[model samples]
Target: MTSHRRPSSPRLGLAALACGAGLALGGCHAERIVADSYPTTVAQRHPIVLAEGSTRLDLPVGAGAQGLTSRQKEDVRAFAADWRKNGRGPIGMMAPAGAFGATAVRSALASAGVPATQIVSQRYTPAGPEEIGLVKLGYVKLKAQVSHACGLWPDDLGSGGGDLYGATENREYWNFGCANQQNLAAQVADPEDIARPRAEAPIYAARRQTIIEKHREGGDTTTGYRQADAVVSDVAKE
Candidate 1:
C-alpha cells in the first residue's frame, strides 16, 4: 500500500508563467503608436521675422494730414525703404500683426545702416467675429494639425499643445489682424503704395524653416512634427 500520490503538477518557471499569462490575455502584441506629428523646426521659424525689430521710415503716417513730425516722417520713410528693400514684399506690411514686427523692422533698418526714430501708432477697430472665427479655424485646422503631425500630442507638455486652444486662438487672432492691415494698406493706395525698390523682396517661404525649427526645440518636437505630418500625409494618401 506504498502508493504515492502522483507528483504535484510541475511548477512553472517565471518565464513560462509569463508566457501563459500573456497567451491568456488574448495574445496582445505591441503596436507602434503614431501621434501624427509635424516639423517643429519649420513651425518655429515662421515667427522669427519679428525678432529683427522696427525699422524707421521717412514716410508720413497720415495721408496729407501732417500728423507726424518731420523726424517721425523720416523714420517712417526709412522703415518703408528698408521694408521695400529687405522685407518680404507686400507681406512685410503685415509685420504689425506679428509679435516682433516692430523689433524686426528696427533691426532690419539698423542692419541696412538706417537711423532709428519713433514709430507712430495707428490703431484700428478689432476684428469682427467672422474674421476671428476664420482665424481660429485656421489655427485649429492648420497649425494644430501641423503640431500634431510632428508626432506631438496635446497631453505632452513638451509638444506645447497643452493649451492648444488658447495658443491657437491667440496666434490666429494676431495673424488675422496683421493680414487685415495688409489688406487695408493695399486698398488705401495704388500698387505704387505697397511697391518696393527691390525687384525681389523676401518671401514668407524662407521663414517656414525657422518656424518649424523653433517649434521643435520648444516642445515635443518629434511628436508634434509626426502628428502634423501624418495628418497631411493621410490627406495626400486619401
Candidate 2:
C-alpha cells in the first residue's frame, strides 16, 4: 500500500505570503535608509585644464617594422602644428627606432603647425648592457617644449591611463568590477551595476578631482601627463 502526505494547509500559504510581504517591506526600508553621507562635490571640486606649453608624446612601434610612412609622418606633423596653433605649447613624440623613427614624428609635428626648427629628435638606447642578447634595442625619442602657457599636460596627466605622455596616471587601481567602474568614471559616464558603486565610484571620483586640482595648480611633473595619447588611442579603438 502506498500512502501520501496531505498538501500544505492554507495557514502555511498565509505564512509564506506574510514572509514575502515582510521581505519586500524590508527591502524598501533598506533602500530608503541613507547610510553615512559625505560631501558629494568632492569629485566636482577639481578643475580641468585643457592646454599647456610644450609636452612630450610617446608612440610605440611594433617589432621588425621599418619607419613611419611618409603619409603617416605628414599626419603627425599636421597634428603637432594644430596643437601648437591652439596654444598647446611644444609637442614632442617618441617611438621605436626601426620603422617608426623620429623623422616620422618630426614630419607630424611639422604638419601639426610646428616649424621644422622647433622639432627635435633623439635616440634612446636601452639602459642595460645586454647589448648583443636576444632582446631588441632601438627606440626613437622626440621632445617638444610647448611655447604657450597652458595646463593641458598637467590636466591630461592626472586623468590617468596610459596617455600620449607615457605616464601611468591611474592611482586607485583595481581589478574586475572596480576596474570597470573606474574606467567608466574616466569617461564620466554612469556605471551599469552594483559592483561599480561598491568597489570603484568613491576612489575614481577622488582621483579625478585630484588630477583636476593638480592641473589647476600648475603641476608640471610628467607623473600624470605621460599616457594621454595611448589612452586616447585605446578609447578610440573601443
TM-score of each: 0.20, 0.27
The parts of candidate 1 lying over 4 Å away from their true place are 1-68, 87-153, 156-238
Stretches of candidate 2 off by over 4 Å are 1-37, 40-67, 74-78, 85-87, 93-100, 127-238
Encode model 1's per-residue lDDT on 26-63: one tens digit a residue. 86345322433333333342221211223322222322
- Model 1 residue 136 CA deviation in Å: 26
Give the 10-residue window scoring lowest on summed lDDT in candidate 1: 135-144
Native RMSD of candidate 2 (Å): 23.5
| lDDT agreement of model 2 with the native | 0.42
Model 1: how far residue 207 lies from native, Å? 36
